[model samples]
Target chain A: MPQSMQPGDAKAAEIKAVSIGKTFGAFHALKNLSLDIGRGEFLTLLGPSGSGKTTFLMILAGFTAPTTGRLMMDGKDITDVPAEDRSYGMVFQGYALFPHLTVEQNIAFPLKVRGHSSADVKRKVAEIVERVGLTGHEKKLPAKLSGGQQQRVALARALVFEPSVLLLDEPFSALDKNLREMMQQEVKRLHQETGTTFVFVTHDQSEALALSSRVAIFNHGELLQVGKPQDVYERPSNRFVAEFLGEINLLPLDTVELNGETAAGKFEDRTIVLNKSITLAGKKAVAAVRPEHMFISASPQTSDCNAITCRVEGATYFGASTKYHLRTRSGTSLAVSMPTASTSPIAPQSDVWVSWPVHQGFLLPDGG
Target chain B: MIGKSITSRKILLLAPLLLFLGLAYVVPFLGVVRWSFTMPEVGLGQYRALMTDPLVQSVFIRTLRICLIVTAAVLVTAYAIAYVWVRGSSVQRMLAEFCILVPFWISVLTRAFGWLAMLSNRGLINTWLQSAGIISEPLALARNELGVIIGMTHFLIPFAVFPIASAMRSIDERVLLAARGMGASRTRIFWTVFVPLTYGGLIGAGLIVFVFALGFFVTPAILGGGRSVMVAELVYLRIFQSPDWGLGAAISVVLVLFIGALLALMRRFIKPAHLIG
Candidate 1:
């Protein structure tokens, strides 16, 4: 799964962005955006649709300019640099391969455009073809190649020059699930071999977790949270972050109070205490518990920090894990995922108890 | 739009233009064709004599040369305009397109009259050139093929600009950006990406402009003033001045065949539907 992947530690080209903002007349496409992408790090800006992810990447690519602030690379200000002069490799969404050129010609394009001699172009393109695992398909036109192969050609063309950074904007969003997964690994391996900083944009959380050294979750034109995938998944800063990373169970303050949970206990059903001291005041204080954290049993247990007795609304048998839907007395529902159910497996419509540790949950600010 | 059945909906949704063309244009064209063949009670005589005439052949050759030059000039200028507009800021692009449209709205008659005012012996340009001591005797600017070509090219710029520009615009700008990000320079990007991507539009526009130029009459008549006679003016002379309707209609039919064959050959190369988006 390439989970052990680590970017080369040595200092490489550093891209430092500072408070970049862009507005398209009436719409604020990007606002107050700033992120310092470490040299050789593969960072992904993860988000749902319309989260300003692509706008941030385009600012880095130099195609769209920030209305305010500046961008620097290795301490050299490059805010106003043209895209062509930025010397970056990019895999555009949908892989905008030149249809008129054959595979060899497409790969040779960058070299020829840089004014390399014809022989040099031929040799360099041939070497890149093999690098991208497209050695035998040089003569084929882009249309003749499958979507995956065309994608590889795009990556190869972008990589042939070995630009300072590689920018990808949903490069595999067009491929099927299997091909997409395969290309994800291929891209990770290529990053390892070349040791280039890759800033990828995508909405797929699993893909982000699979590839990035760190993932930055974005929402409503702001960076919601950024950390190692595991860290971010296990610990999100707010409700949006918690919900965006994965499926989350939101416990209202009352639910915590009824269970006598000290962490995030209720105060007027709006505020809660995560500890003995703090009285968090808000219209709605909510705690997010991951679906995997909750366990289902045949009966309620008093010792459990957080437990609720609800009817087993439904059950799903996945080969390895069994998921159960439990509805509380207040009609609130929760999903509990576990490797195996009890010896007396809870059936649908049967009363059951759900339990999880208090420390596993977090209080998120109300979305409003 | 060019085929029989005039309304061949199976061919294209816009096929009704062929019907409109047949009614308004083909009827008059056939009438001319019949008139050119059966004048003076009929024979192969008027066309045969007309073909042998040295003046008629020279004028035909001269018109072909004029059309080629004007087409070339318009294509180059239109490409430059479209390229600049495509890459410029939105405001500049809108302004450039608006500027191109301005010359189109001004009538050809008014523009030719404006050219007459500008290129006459005592006209504004010649007056300035004379005052600047750059030329003498008005430089024979008017009453020649030079005046005719200038006016014709001026009127034909929009036809040359539209199809090519639309084609160029449809070419995903991302392809050029991808090439550049891969280390392509401006000139390389132009020749390899932009040129090839928009080739169909350019050729289509060029063919249209060249074909339209072959049959132009008003600008050439007003500008050339009998010193430079294009084939259209020669046909007019044969029809009305000499009462040689047979020669005139034959010339008209020949011109139609020339332009029609060009349109057909162009359709073969420039089918926008088969072109990859």
Candidate 2:
């Protein structure tokens, strides 16, 4: 094993799940979910807690057996294989470094277990330790290192053996925002450099979007959608995916109709058009618009845009953006986020117009 | 000084226990040391006899050997029980605790007698073996080194298990899972990760069991069948039966010094924090 195994050197594994289901006694954790992870792909499983993303990740790692399913690796049945036999590197949520071992020993554990010679283990340990920026701290125990340093040790230990797949369960959840972003970039760089198949699980949507080549959104034991981050974020299949990814404004509409590839719906007293068409048999539907897409102004600004008049009830000032919370005359609530640099701050309780271009809003089945 | 002022107040609170220890343990121990040295000629007569006495040397060696055996056996058995206590389900944990507590709460003499009954020739074990046609005659199971070891190990097991179990409970469950994910086999994970993590508990338990075993008197006397003459039995013989108080005091002094040396050696390897935390 080398210190930093190249992506081309790794045997990146392609994994497929066939209708996997898991049950803990009477409670079902995951239901009939099938997903195929391509070789050398950074696929992230994104979901809220208890949405079975971690369970699915555990099943993929072969730590948890599915009650009913078949897992295949490169078309070979591996459902019965144990985690040790699978040789998948996992950076657990807490890092899980051996408290008794120094950083170098912890990184060299896998190599030593595989019966490598002392010289080979030493060389690989030195290389990976330096690669992880842990050169002078190789002799320091896990308890002596800071959280980010310990995290790097875990990452180095996992990558040193050049496993077929790398599984991470919210590895950055414990880190602060700045360190998390830095680690995420480090993870992405490592993935690109090694070209190893990476399966990451996280509830943080931004993290999922920033790191993954493909993101799998899960909810209520079901795989809601799996696609590129842009595809999933821009065109969420349902209201859950739409709202879960980020803050979205959903407005109930009536008499929904699909004309060619555009959706038209009646909202309040005006007819609105959606850029993307959705097939909903019922007349009741909802128009889902992202908070950033909606622009708030002291008065109506555009003639052909979809607009609603409302009172600004609240304004939250982020560093780069300000979000205005508004309530319509009919008591419907809406939110609009605008760049702080471009827009003057709107006072709370001010009457404003929340509008978006016709193509920015999409329609979804109502009450789902 | 602030430190002196605080210590003065603290001394008032600690006065009762300090008085009790000084009167109850320290004074008596000092008396024994004085008697051992100043009994006959106020010289090294008892010490010289101890060096030249073959009987005393044999008993001291036998005591050391038996204590070592009991410590090893108790450590192994306790570790197995503690592992189960940590990883097993509720019922298994309850059962393991029950087994350890039963021997722990019972009187030491009663437990030794119980072992004596079970291990005595023609007792439960030998009778069963004979009935099963495994042996033509009853085996010498009791009143020997093996019998003494078994009885003492049973007595020391609960003491050994608690510290190890505490250490085991402190280990993060995810560490083992991480090891398995990193391609370590089950046995490898146990030895490499799990065992090393429990070293503090092992050292604490080992110190407790070995020190207590060194001074053991009851179980060995009952189960040893007069064949295993340990230091405690020799002390008893010298003090009570033979009426040689000076010699007994000298042997007691040696035992105390040996235990102190063992503790000092172990203290270098085991941090006091590990024992408490």
Candidate 3:
């Protein structure tokens, strides 16, 4: 929770990207994206492929120059500085470990390049190797190590220099699921230990949510939203952000009206209430709720909850939870997930009451 | 049994190539080896004479020296060209490839003659210098060891460029970027990371150019103008000019053994996989 310090606190803004845009010929890779990375914060740029997240990371690393923007660091513009002069550490996708160098040499490269004494290089390399749990594998080449081991070497190499900022470009994308999770925990621990500003890019939403203090959602070269993981996931600003984060049930609403700190709208025969207070620019809106927030039962659980009657069309059993796919009378499809141990075996075709807290549902402009 | 049969079938597919090499290369080489030993009334006299002859010793020494110089020069020049080929902009890469391949497609004799036309005394270079009043006399730019070295280096640059460029192309570009991001300067990245990664290519190209330079016949013969005689030219002289078949065969055997020893020495430094790559 190092990001608890708000980005608006000017002193905490370690790196600020202002009005960044990149275009190649006729194709725009990134629009005028503006963001602030707080000091010692773990911020993940989450998006689908071709969302220009990687392009932004490259700009921050100084590997790619912005077409029109000013990159500020410590209140100074660094837009024209080259990558080598920026002194930021980067872990590229696929690790990019030096194939010809041994693990120790690979980790020692940055130190040696900075003209550290041989003794200092050796001591630092040994220390980081042990920190990454690669003590015994120091003498091996990258090709001789496993995928996870190579990833550790890449991490150790990037962190050994004690850079002020660390940028990772999908470092764990090549690992198996188990190893990727393990590496994720390792990176989280490293981030806490180093207290360095970390900007990570990944297409995997779960990884973005689990590791980052704040996740910035991107799509089609635009910065859609940036916020704390829970805030963004629970209350996405648009349809793309809601859908990209995870499975969400969207029900069309009509005659939407804004109340003091809530919005009341109608969905067919049910009156839907959203907890967020916002100005409505259009009459049409959609009620958005995560599948996990909704529950299926034979009867409505409480009066405070928004409830709808739907026919269960199908159910999918995941080891930990059962997902019931339901369709309302108006032909709006919805999904409700319940813990397997707590749910009764509701057969398909059974009519049920799907209920959720009114505060859990949010409203988005329809088709946005 | 099935595995054995499959292996045998694969070997059978190599029958024609094996037959051709055995007849065209191994068989003639065996004859030369036999003549080196048995010629001149079944004794090692020719080899003993080779050891004592000053002309043969100087020729061998000079040939080794020239080949070493050419190999070094070709490697340094080819590495620059190969780097441009792999990492340059599209226009630069196309220009580099044109420079390498255009000369490569032209015959060696044509290239040697071209060098002669430019470098020989009273030729283009000398005539231009004289006309420009830069020199009172034409310089001895050709018809010596320097001429031989220049011609051989030019003839062999394209050979060295291919392997070096291929090796450079195989390097993961991210490794360089990673180094740069870690604050390594461009020069440090090139010397420490880029060059070391292409070591396999450098070694492979060096071996090819050095081996080819050792037995170079046309460039040295035409450009040397009978002065700088390499092992191959000496072998031709002894066999065809002096008609001393036994001495020539002895020299040829020694050359082959020298190349074999070089290969063995090089194998200690490079892995077979690196050579193939």
TM-score of chain B of each: 0.89, 0.92, 0.93
Q: Which candidate is the best by DockQ?
A: 3
RMSD of 1: 4.7
Residue-by-residue lDDT tens digits, candidate 3, B138-199: 99989999999999999999888988888898889899899899888888889999999889
State the lDDT of candidate 3 residue by residue for A1-368, as single tens digits. 22222333322239999999999788899999999998889999999999999999999999999998899998999999999999888899999999999999999999998999999998888888888999789899999999999999999998888888889999999999999999999999888877788999999999999999999999999999999999899988899999999999999997888778888888888888887634666658899999999999888877779998999999999989999999999999999999999988999999999999988999988888
Query: Considering lDDT, which of the candidate structures 1 and 3 is the better prediction for this target?
Result: 3
Q: Write the per-residue lDDT of candidate 1 for residues A119-173, one digit (tens) a residue.
A: 8887778777887789789999999999999999999888776677999999999
**Every candidate's TM-score, chain A alone:** 0.88, 0.95, 0.96
Cα lDDT of model 2 by residue, A1-368, tens digit:
34356658788999999999999999889999999999999999999999999999999998999999999999999999999889898999999999999999999999988889999999888888877788899999999998899999999999888888999999999999999999999999889988999999999999999999999999989999999999889888888899899999988887887888788887777678896556787657899999999998777757758887889899888989988889988788988899999998888888878889987888887876
Q: Please name the candidate that would achieve the greatest TM-score relative to the true structure.
A: 3
Q: How does model 3 score on DockQ? A: 0.86
Q: Rank by DockQ, descending?
A: 3, 2, 1
Best model per lDDT: 3
DockQ each:
0.57, 0.80, 0.86
lDDT of 1 by residue, B107-176 (tens): 8899998898887677788999989999766776777999898888888987877777778878887887
Q: lDDT of model 2 at residue A361? A: 87
